[model samples]
Target chain A: MEFSSKLLENAVNEISQLPGIGKRTALRLALHLLRQPKENTHGLSKALNQMVDDLKLCKSCHNISDTELCDICANPMRKTDVICVVEDIRDVMAIENTASHKGLYHVLGGKISPMDGVGPHDLNISSLVEKVKSGSVKELIFALSPTMEGDTTNFYIYKQIKEFEVETSTIARGISVGDELEYADEITLGRSILNRIPFENSLKL
Target chain B: MEFSSKLLENAVNEISQLPGIGKRTALRLALHLLRQPKENTHGLSKALNQMVDDLKLCKSCHNISDTELCDICANPMRKTDVICVVEDIRDVMAIENTASHKGLYHVLGGKISPMDGVGPHDLNISSLVEKVKSGSVKELIFALSPTMEGDTTNFYIYKQIKEFEVETSTIARGISVGDELEYADEITLGRSILNRIPFENSLKL
Candidate 1:
């Protein structure tokens, strides 16, 4: 799109650099910004710059945070002994939102996908190993997705810290509460059947 | 969605303020920005702030520009006597991209929408009237959209400039090229039929 203003064109170009936003969408966003009060642009740019500059990674779990230690790891009420290992900060947010877990998290940053050039060393496996080696963590729950990459990362982390004598378990794979068992994939349905828990355990939720 | 960082939360809130972006998408975009190099965030923020701060409205056409007069209005090759009226800068950009018209533009800023509390006084119509009153402009083309508000704007402007003795015309309304007649909307098809041009005129392009 030809822009009469160079500033408009530059803003649109920078905005379209974001994931999933095309030139048309960037133009729409830019025009929307133009129509709003001047303070709106200042607010947006300030927020973005602050987010970038003030952003920090939790030293313990490698999760994105504003401080050295994330809220989950810093909370004494939450059990640091039980570390829920996951792929990224989004997973941390998702699990925290559910309130299903009362433990700290170990964000691996990404899965160990050889196809994507992400190896075990590329993740936070070494620090997680160090945490387990400190003899404080008693359990490491694998909450990564059930994909091959997720399983591989889980196994790799487990192997790295198995000698520390920590209890390790994967999150349950089963037919969701509202899902039909028949519609579930063969492996998931089969696993659900094999790993069936007591009726009272399913009643917790 | 709960965020671990206040900066992240603020950024997400500001980003989702944009049209069509939701909370989840905002978080995704914010996280994506965080994952990139620091320079990327700086570049984006700088571009947005600079765009807002350095922006200017062309004195002649009221289009967004870097100077008093927009490039098209300032161009000596373009016909100064002919003015294509449009609702906003985007419409000007769309027409300019087509390269079909070589006339100067008079951006009205917006249409007359009483329901939305927008009236002729809210737009840049007075400046346009002054341009027509100058008597240097001979042809005032109504290139505004076909919507009710656009037509109202066109009619309002025509009335304002009619005493100036300038010729007025609207952009053609017809079935789009490569569109099926059966699938075309009723009003557009009817107008296309009613305003049928000579066979030789149709063969010009």
Candidate 2:
């Protein structure tokens, strides 16, 4: 697309560099900013710049944070001895929203994807191992997504701390609560059947 | 969704304020930016702020431009006497891509939409009428979208310029070039038949 103004073209180019945003969408967004009050654009720019420049990761969990430790890690009531291992802060937030996991989180930052040149060494795995070796963590739940990389990361971490006394387990794999059985993928369906719990256990929830 | 960082939340809120973007998409975008180099975020913020602070509208046609006159308005090769009226710079860019029209453009900024509290006075209509009254323009082609507001805007401009010696016409309404006849909408199909040009006229294109 041809832009009449150099500044407009620059803005569109920068915006389209974001994931999932195209040139057309960038143009629309740039035009929307142009039509809005100057303060709105300035506010957005300020917020983005500030977030990128000053945002922190929790020293304990490696989750995105405003301070040295994230709120979840800092909360005294949260179960520090039980840490939930996940891919990123988004997963941490998702699990937090459900209020199902009272444990602290250990964000791996990303999965161990050899296809993307990301290895175990590049993740927060070493610190997690250190935490386990310190003998403070009693249980480390693997909460990454059900993918090849997730399984690989989980196995890799499990191997690192297997000698320790910490109990290791993965989150349950099952069909969604409201989904039809026929619509469930074959692997999930098979796993759900294999991992079926007692009827009494199901009622506990 | 809960954010561990205040800056992250602020950035997501600002990004979500853009049209069609929701909270989830905003968070994804923010996280993507965070994962990238600080330079990417800084570049985007700088570009947006610079554009909002420095971008200008063409003095003659009101198209978004870096200078007083837009490229089309400044071009000596283009026909200044035949002006194409459009809704915004997007339409200007769309028509420019076709390379069919050799005339200049008059951007109305937006259409007459009462539902949106927009009217002729809210647009650049008065300046367009003044341009026609100046007598340099011999023909004005209304190229607004075929919507109720577009029709109202076209008629409003036509009424304002009726006293002038200049001629006024709306772009032809018809089925798209590659569309199937059976799938064509009733109004468009009927208008195409009613406004059919001579066989020889069609051959000229």
- Top-DockQ structure, candidate number: 2
- Model 2 lDDT at residue B156: 90
Where does candidate 1 stray beyond 4 Å? A180-183
Q: What DockQ results for candidate 1?
A: 0.83
- Number of clashing pairs per prediction, in order: 0, 0
- How far does residue B150 in candidate 2 sit from its true spot (Å)? 1.1
Cα lDDT tens digits, model 2, A1-205, are: 8778899999999999999999999999999999999999999999999999999989989999899988888899998899999999889988989999998999999999999999999999999999999999999999999999999999999999999999998999999999999999999999999999999999999
Query: What clash pairs does model 2 have?
Result: none
Deviation (Å) of B113 in candidate 2: 0.8
RMSD of each: 1.8, 1.2
Tell me, by lDDT, which candidate is best.
2
Q: Per-residue lDDT of B74-159 in model 1, one digit per residue for the tens? A: 89999999999998888998999899999999888889999999999999999889988989888988998899999999999888
In terms of TM-score, which candidate is strongest? 2
